[model samples]
Structure formats: C-alpha cells, structure tokens
Target: MTISNHASVPETIALPPKEFSRTLYAYVVWGGLALALLWSWAPAEMDRVTYLFSDSGNMVEYASGFLTPNFHDWDYYVQEMILTVQIALWGTVLSIFFGIPFAILSSSNVAPIWIVQPVRRLMDACRAINELVFAVLFVVAVGLGPFAGVMALFVHNLGIIAKLFSEAVEAIDPYPVEGIRATGASKLQEIIYGIIPQVAPLWISFSLYRFETNVRSATVLGVVGAGGIGQILFESIRGFYYGETAAILIIVVITVTVVDLLSQQLRKLAI
Candidate 1:
C-alpha cells in the first residue's frame, strides 16, 4: 500500500528535469560577450595583474603623503565649500521649477500622447548628457564661474526630477482625479486640486535627494573652471599638494555625509 501511494504521488507531482546543457550554453554566451567587451575597450598595453604588482610600491609611497592631512588652509577651503553649496542650492531650485511642468506634460495619464512624447524625449536628451559636458558648454557660453555650474546642474537634474515626478504622478490614485472631473473642474483645476496634493511629498523628497546629489556634482564642476573648491582641489593635485587635496576631500566628505543624513531624515518624516 505504501509503495503504491508513493508511486501515485510521483505521477501527481511530476517536475521538469534540470537542463544543465542549456545553462552551460547560457554561461558560455555570457562569457564570450564579456571577453568581446574587454578586447574591444581595454588599454592595449594594460596587463591587469602584472601592473598592480609591479607599480604597487610607488602607488603606496605616493598615497602615504595623504595620510597626514593638513588643514592649514581651512578658512579658504570653507569659503569655497560655501560657494559649492550655494551653486547646488540654486541648481536644485531651478530643476524643481523647470521639472514640474515638464513632468506633468510627460505623464501619460495627465497629458495627450503628443505632449508626452516630445517632453519625454527632451528629458531623455537632457539626461543623456552628463553634468560635466553641460558644464563645459555653459562655461564656454557664459564664460566660467558658478553660473555655468548652476546651469549644468539645473539641466541635468531637471531631467532626473522630471522622470521621477512623472512616475509619481502616474502612480497616483485615480479616484480623486475622477471626483474633481465630476464637479466640472477644468483640466488645470483637476491637476491642481487632485494630483498635486497626492504627489507633493514625494516631489519634495525627490528634490531634496537630488539636492544632496548636486552638492557632490557641483564640487567636480569647478574643475572645469565653473568655480568652487574643485578648482583648488584640481590645482592642488596638479601641483602634488597631496596634503591639501586630502584636506579638501575630507571637507567634502563631511559636508556630503551631513547633507545625506539630513535628507534621509526629512524623507522619513515627510513620507
């Protein structure tokens, strides 16, 4: 009786056998793709393992200079760091200002297909270009300083915020929008009275998060003559002032950490 029941259970619960050959074929294909990528782009003279072993001592010796960080120029560093923060602040504000309308236009539920496609494509173009590239272009057009950095961050972050905001808008509960329409509310009124309230917290949170990110990006923007601590850091590195570079890095790290923590707290509180 027990043997019959066990045999019947096998018939009831038949499972497909594992396909080891198929899995092996998949792994081979992936491995071949990886090899092709490496072959196409890797530096011609690069010997991955040999270089690390051969030049390790010199790398260690140079790195050792940064171990004892010198903060003798802390005052200048702090002043420039303030400028970086200010640039990021203005950039984030501009992104929010520009992103909101585009976000609405890009939302499938909110706008017609024609409006959505063009706005979304424009955002895609904005996001495809890196902040550094925008910074260089703006610097050439506007001629250096924090204005260029602000514009670069604004354009790049605009795309990111718009993409995020549209997703938030699309995910909103439909009932409120319907209720607003039932009252003969205009299209603009429906968006204002129904959609904005639902997504406002998330929009603010996203903006804060982007602001935190922009702070770090603004530092690098100065390297291209956008004007901030990055300029000093770049010069220090070029002049082999490892100590100053280390100090600047420390300040940036501390500032970023504090901002990140604060933003996280705000997100938790708001959400």
Candidate 2:
C-alpha cells in the first residue's frame, strides 16, 4: 500500500446511436410540404409575381381614393357600428349558453365514449362550415336581418366554444374531481363543483376572445344580408363610394381596437 502516484481513469460511456427513423420522418414531412406548395403554385397564380410591380399605378390610383374619408354620415355609421356590436353580444351569449352542455358532452374525461364520439363529430361538422355560409343560409330562413347574423355566429361559435371549453375540461387537475367523487357526489355535482371551478377562468377568457372575433365576423355578415355595418360597407364598395368605404373601415378598425383592449383587460382579470 505504498503511495502509488497514479489516478484511476473514469470509464468513457458511449452515447446511443441517433435513430434513422426520426431523420426519415423529418424528410417525409418536409417533402410533403414542398409537394403541396408545388402542386398549388400554378393554380394559385404564382407566375404573376411581376404583376404587382407592373400594375403599381392602378393600385396607387385606387388606394388614393381612400386617403380622404367622408364622414358626412358619421351618425349613421356610429349607429350601424353599435348594432354590429349588439349582434356580436347576442351571438356570443347564445353560443355560451348552448356550448356549455355540448362542451361537457364532448369532453372525453367527462362523458362516455359513446356520447363523446357523436357529440364531437357534430361539433366537427359545425366547426368545419364557415360562419359566412351559415349566415347565407340563415338569411334565407330569417329574411335578412341582424337576427340571421346572430344565428350564424351562435351556431359557428357554439362549436368553437365547445371545443375550447372541452379542451380546458380535459386538462383539469383530476385530484379535485376525485375528491368530489370520494365524497359521494353525483356525476353532475362533481362536474359543477370541481370541473367548473377549475376551468372557469379559462372558459371566461375563451368566451371573451370569441366575442372579440365575433364582432369582426359580424361586420362581414352584413354582406350576406345578415344586417350590421358590413352591409353598408359592402354597399359603399359596390357603389364605388370609396370615401364612404374609407370612413366605414376606419370606424370598424376603431371599434375592433376598443373591443380588443376591453377583452384583454377582462381576460387578465379572469385569469
């Protein structure tokens, strides 16, 4: 045991080899994306890239008309803008009312597979169709008014709200729900006490966000005779009253900005 002036060397551990499957998967994903773009390029008119530069004068002349907005009918514009907001309010409220039950039914953690599958498929159908298409149909049924717009938004947003809320429900901490069940609480009671409390903040935030989106969508619904400022805006555009179009667009921008700000503040409070 005499001092052996030697230090023991640590073993060199080898790292596992990188998997070839991951690299192949990455290449497949990128190749698929490239193929999609290539396939659509001609149909999408990718060859017209030089047209913007060549036709710059026409764009300038068209855009110049919007530089001076005519607010002569400012009162009417404000009134229609308010009506648009009202449409969004009613639509969002109705969606929230109907979406709650659908959300619960669609949630995998809350409902049985038999119920969840059908409810989710229904929601998928609702979500797949655009609100504009729904607006067109409702206009036919309701005879062209804000009511049609309300129904359109309500139907489309119901699907969206349910999807958002179900996702929130699925992600909830299961401990509280388990505790409620342990206390001999019924299924509905467990959901009401445990699930609702956990997801309330997120649900409120989602609803507010949808309300903001609905406001913007409501503005366009008027084009389909669903009523609101979008009808007037479309008229101005069709009539080539560029000044009036500019004024209406300005009002829309301001209203959307204000709604966005208010919703953001409310979301902060909710969280």
Candidate 3:
C-alpha cells in the first residue's frame, strides 16, 4: 500500500509570559505612597497658623465691593489696551521673522552639526531667561516705556519661536525631503520644495499661540513701568481704588478671551 505524502506541521511558538497584574500593582502602590507623602508634608496646623482663610467675611466684603466693576473709566482702559495690542503684534511679527531662520539653521537635517549645535545652544540660552525678567531688565535699560516692553517680548519670543520651529522641523516626515533630494535638488531646495509645505501649518499655529501669550505678557510689562494697562491696574489697586481695579480686570479678561476665541477659530480654519 502507498501512503500519500504530506508536509510536516510547524509547532506553535509560545508567547513570553506577562506580568501585567504585578506591574499594575506596583504603579498603584507608587501612586498611593506619593500622594500620602504629599498629604503628610502639608500639616493641618500650618493652614490654621496662616491667615489665608481665617475670615471668610473679609473675602466676601472685598468681592462685593469690587466684583460689581465700574466701567465709567472705559476711555482710559481702551487707550492702554490699544497700546498693549500694538506691543503684542509687533513682538509677534519680530519673533516670526527671526525665529524661522534660526529654526532652519539649527535643525540637524537642514544644517551640519558644527552649525546646528551652536545655534541651538544659543537659542536655548536666550529662552532660559524668563520674559518678565527681560522686561524688567529692558525697562531699566530703556528708562521705562512701551519700547522696553517691545524689546523684552522681541528677545524672549525670538528664542521661544526658534525652539518651537526647530522642533517642528525635526518632527517632519523624511520621505518628501528624500524624494526631492533624489531629483538632484540641493539641500536648501529640498527643504523649500518638500519640507516647508508640511511644516507651514504647525509654524503658523505656534506663532498664533505666541501672539496670544505676548498680549497677556505685554499687559503686565507695564507694571514694571514699561507702560501698558498693568500700570493702571497696579496703581488703582495700590491706592485702594478697588472698583477701578475691577473694571480694568474686566476689560483685560474680555480682550484676552476674544483673542483666544479668534485664535481658536483661525487654528481650526488652518487645520
């Protein structure tokens, strides 16, 4: 009798054993201990010693007097606000102009290591100094005005925008750039033809975000005598003109909210 030929069957390989439950338990234990340690450090006695919430009536009184808000000084608020808007706009434009080139030069794929690393380090160093610190420094240097505020926003934002733009460049897909290079395109041409199109949306989005942030920052720059709505707000609060402070706060809150909403809509349209 002849037997039919058949191929030998392959054995199934076992999957490595998993310790999912054990790993989950470890995470839970770590989280609980961390929370417990935080809670223990913040003693209940510390809260009582501080007058933070000692008298609820004091807070209620302040709120009642100030929360109503007096917009009778609307004209002054509007003028300072216009100056604040100007500072933010100028700052954002300067940031975008300087930042894009720095980002390109600092990117590894775009620039050689010798060039890229130095530019990156410089940008990081610039960004390490806080915007408010720069504002204070510039205010001192320029003798206090909107120009000081503008310069503060310009330097700080130049660094920040550069970092963000470089990150965007690094995160891009390499295929398009490769394809362009394959066509005998130079490095700059490859970037201009292939990478820029993909990165433009993200770059614009970051710029808008910086613009909104600059607006808020420009407001406070005045408090240091750089000149903006912050100076008005600070003086009013110092003199115990609580109603005036409330009105200024209302104006600022409304303006910022509008900018935020507009930016959101623009981003949506962009995407």
Best by TM-score: 2
Ranked by lDDT, top first: 2, 1, 3
lDDT by residue (1-271, candidate 2, tens digit) is 6454497655796889889999899999999999999999999999999888899998899999999999999999999999999999999999999999999999999999999999999998888999999999999998889999999999999899999999999999999999999999999999999999999999999999999999999999999999999999999999999999999999999999999999999999878
Model 1, residue 59: distance off in Å is 0.8
Per-residue accuracy of model 1 over 1-271 as CA lDDT, tens digit each: 3657443454376678879999999999999999987896657655566877689999898999899888999999999999999999999999999999999999999999999999999999999999999999999999989999999999998999899999999999999899999999999999999999999998989989899999999999989999788999999999999999999999999999998999999998888
- In angstroms, the error of model 3 at 122 is 1.5
Identify the candidate with maximal lDDT: 2
Q: lDDT scores for all predictions?
A: 0.93, 0.96, 0.88
* For model 2, the run of ten residues with the poorest summed lDDT: 1-10
In order of TM-score, best first, we have 2, 1, 3
* lDDT (C-alpha) at residue 63 in model 1: 91
- Tens digits of per-residue lDDT, candidate 3, 122-160, equal 998879987778889998898888888888898899999
Q: What is the lDDT of candidate 2?
A: 0.96
Give the TM-score comparing model 2 with the true structure, all chains together. Answer: 0.93
